[model samples]
Target: GGLPYVLTAHEGSAAFAADVMGRLTGAPGLCIATLGPGATNLTTGVGNAYLDRSPLLALTCNLPTAQLGRRIQMAIDHHALFRPLTKATLALREGAVASVLAEALQVALSEPLGPVHLDLPEDVALAPATEAVPAPPSGRRLAAAPEPARRRAAELLGAARRPVAVLGSSAMRLRNPGLLQAVIERHRLPFATTTMAKGMISEEHPLSLGCIERARRQVQRELLGGADLVVGLGYDVVEVEYEAWLGKVPLLSIDVDPVDADASVTIAHEVVGDLDASLGWLAQLPPARPEWGADLAARHRERFQRALRPPRAGFVPHHAIDVVRAALPRDGILAFDVGAHTHQIASQWTAHAPRTFLITNGWSSMGFGLPAAIAAKLACPERPVVAIVGDGCFQMTVGEVAVARRLGLSLPIVVLDDGWLSLIQVKQVRRRFGLYGTDLGEQALVDPPAHYFGVPAIGAGSAAELARALTDALVADHPTVIEARVDPGHYLDTVYD
Candidate 1:
């Protein structure tokens, strides 16, 4: 009764559930599937979660050892296939269930938290084993900054006149929302977050600059390049181009793993420690005077304020996001998939609390939103959960809609129908690269829109239509989907360009 779950109609949804759950919940998220195709169908989601460095555990059933190579149709190389997608992949021995489960969890939760896979033979789940359950091992250390490293990081942040902390997916995973806020408030640091770290600190907080698309904001980019001390708190390399753009700024890197710490550029100091513990140590240190950073913070705040203005009319994408925010519950949960819509939602939505939003930060996978929405609703059924996805993404896992209906999951899904692979199109436009397979022009937008089982559904063409659709969907008692048809040109101009 305490948690809500979405058993999507397909394996892709299962993978998405694992990712979304991993993103929102600090603990490792788990997903299970039957043998054969159920396991293969989850490939994309698993890869996405793995690449994004979400803490996830995926369990898939396999053909019994007795039938391993007897030409059975269900028999295939699941273990080998999943090897590349997970940091560790183990085939569960019939009598070693306890050990396998323990190992899988340990690896998934270890430093640089990422997905782990355990393939169980079908017979193991049904067979009786006489072996003793092994105790989970100790001394499997997670990464954290040592005392000296912590002191160094603190000294850097404490002394720098113009210092700023850039938060990332790892910070969200470390579960130190209050730490960021404390440091920001204490030093009056105006911080920016990558799309994945949207809800780490409530956007309404005074120090929050906004969800930063690194390519577009010139002033924020300049500030990042020029800051004397760039405190990367749990920042991941995949989310930001720090090496290329951060200029000569010295980075005081703090994260859960050595790999993430190693990816830092212009490092004056590195602290690989549990994020919370490191932050706690830093919290004990005196705040550095905000001499050089105060004016810079004010200027960035002004730019941030101007950028917060949502487009008022026409078929603008930002306006659609505003409509959803206005219509939904302020405490509502937003589960976003990776695509053009992901950044737009993060930039536009105001995350007011922790666990209120989810994103595929590490991998930026496309078909994650619907499954995440289901998982969020399952975890917190009473709160409204909104999923923002792309039309291509919707079609990738649209069948999950039926799963939501059958399972009685009440989620409102918003599909951005830009008809083309908007992100790729933008990349193509900017680089003058010949586009190969990224176009989705022939794809259908469901002019009338499709329903989620019995839930109401509509296809919106204008800003007013989206507002009306969202109003009812947000208030509806059951599942609903609003497919907003958008112009392909309306997106984060920087990244796409």
Candidate 2:
């Protein structure tokens, strides 16, 4: 009863809040809604958590028990509807409410965390509870690495002259990132992160190669070619397909779950247990060569720096991101929506800490950045939060700005207004299919006296103007939307190429 709740403009998009909260807090995020249409609306967010492996508790108030079996108004089967999107779905019974809720929490918090569903029937919810609520379950324990697997992994790593570590979303769950960093540092291993795990390790570190996003695939491919062994730490196939890892070099996987063998990626050795414990074991082994990929990392960094300094002729997305990076505090949080802009941002934006850069890479869902930014702000109110979204994504969740304004959050929504579904348009053009549904004809919303659902709307046409607009928006006491008129032509060279 003492818990706090935040309301959103759309119930379906509320899962984005849970997604960000769960990720940032490493705890089960709570999202509540009424039954039928309300529950249906929550499915996108729930499914997002499911695929992204963000722990969430989805609570939906259902019709009374008497009306459950009948074909009455708003009485859809919540269990059946949520079954596919959750780790488990249970309807709250009168006497076992506390136990059911506890069990749901456990399932959601277990390894490879995901969303769980509980349909609280109105009658059951109103009924008196005689049973006492059980104590919360003990913290999850990490299984120690097996001796034989540890030996195999150590031998493989020791024999390799060039080893590179690939960090993925699961790495974010590590209880101690320092232990993993020690392993990388002690071995001088050149490392890169998956798109979803871009900030798992600080990108500013000397060993950081960069994120494995589409924009940096060329550099990553070159580095992977020279790698004698690929050490995957907390790697998940959902972020980057196994096919991308298939090659002559064998992989050494360390994760809570077994490798996805069907991906055709070779796993020479594996240590399945807590990632921290696995890394702890690896850290104790004799350090590998100190200069395995130092030259490669330097080359990668050189190329990356050049990419970050894009032409400033007009409002370039990369330059805009660079400006945003300089403006926001080093620890401030940034959320990105799926689009051409995301490729550059995810690749070039150097995250100082985990959870600083949030994106739905696994789900690659649109309309996630704005809502996720709101959730990030609520979770860490001290740090500034901003959403970098595409014009198409902004339209999908523009209504959420009202929710942000109502909460009096000083969040800024920076929309890259290119007047089209730029990513799709690029793909269509590359595939020799003329533009069909990608264009969004000119519709001026940033004219004088412009307001986006009561939130101030500012326009920025150049890097300098975008910086000024962002500065004003960040200092404002309320949410503001900066519509930056950007050119999508860069996608032809950076992404579609």
Candidate 3:
């Protein structure tokens, strides 16, 4: 196998590493660990993959069969521990390795993809087996939309005075942008995406309404309520809760699997088949009312423009986002860590293509930015990759930078230093409880001592300096860490009313 193996400092962070690898490569990612603490450490990443719907295979080394269930050191029920977090959990048997691995891989790559766990006891690993390796699993065959279902979906869309498309994470799997674009253009439909599907369609497109998580509630209400039919293109309940559209609109789900909406959300029609095929069918139907969502699109554009403008002073996250957006090439990929900065960046960052802006909104896990950047760089070595992370998140997995340096990766990591868990601090202020245990003191990650991890470090306290630093980092031959001092109160101005 030509697969490269890179070790991380912590097992918990391995989740982000595998998540980014799966997300970028569209293959089942592998994460390895030993029993006890290593196995427990993998739980965070495993659970994150489970919720985020990334295909991951968690391999752990367990105790021997004889030692199982005994009060031995580093012994625990690995199967029971991972059962809830994985699609399937198995203890590897000496003679069944081939079939077990094949089955586990299949489950991991299936629709609504998730993590699978395999516990390999030391004795089982050393046991002699005569069984031959099984053949690789066959390629997955996508289900096509049935004629009757297609007709019903077409009829519903045709009858509606106003139709809108709500794209979700599952749409990313379609990989048929042209067909989806045709459907949207043919119907003159205004489209919105979940946070995870930020770049499903280019936000720069005229009909795009950006991300739902970034939109104001009133805007979401008006757009969704005004629609006579809401066409869900590969929507997943895990990405965006059904409560958002419940009783607000009539949904027509079009996905590989049937709609997973709960009782509150009523799906009028469902086309349970391939996304591209369904969209191709819809594209062949008569276009909806030409001016159905024109007004809403205009308002969305207005808000999008307003959101991109630089603040009067200070290092505003949106301003930083705009600077980075301009600095990187159109196809460059950006990974964001979970924090107050994510919401603003999700709204303001204009992704020109799919898979450009990566974030962990599904798991909302911190310290994902750096690992995601590493995967992005590996996936597209020719394209630029940057990680925009918060101070708290950077501290969580900052040591990974050493790995990046050793691998000779020229990754630009921008650390937003606010001296606090800014997202939680904002929530605390809103609740009038005051910030406690959130502060990390007034620490700035400026100039590193010479040869610090063999990486250059830069510090910026203003928008201009930050932009300049990013420009330099982008062209640098080695890894660069940019510590940007930003206002902690900026979240209040951008996120809240």
- Candidate order by TM-score, highest to lowest? 2, 3, 1
Which scores better on TM-score, 1 or 3?
Answer: 3
Clashing pairs for model 2 are 12-41
How many collisions between residues are there in candidate 1? Answer: 11
For model 3, the superposed segments whose C-alpha errors exceed 4 Å read 127-131, 139-142, 215-218, 245-247, 257-266, 293-299, 307-312, 443-452
Q: Give me the candidate number with maximum lDDT.
A: 2
Model 1: ten consecutive residues of lowest lDDT: 488-497
Which lDDT tens digits does candidate 3 get at residues 40-115? 9988888888888888899999888788889889998999999999999987988888889998888888766889
- Candidate 2 lDDT at 50 equals 91
lDDT of 1 by residue, 320-424 (tens): 777878877768988877776665676667787767877776666677788888888876777888888887888788788887788776677888887777777
The candidate maximizing TM-score is 2
Q: Write the per-residue lDDT of candidate 2 for residues 353-432, one digit (tens) a residue.
A: 87788888777888889999999998999889888999899889989999999899999888888888988888898899
Report lDDT per candidate: 0.73, 0.83, 0.80
How accurate locally is residue 301 in candidate 1, as Cα lDDT from 0 to 100? Answer: 61
**Native-to-model Cα distance after best TM-score fit, residue 232 in candidate 1, in Å:** 0.6
List the pairs of residues colliding in candidate 3: none
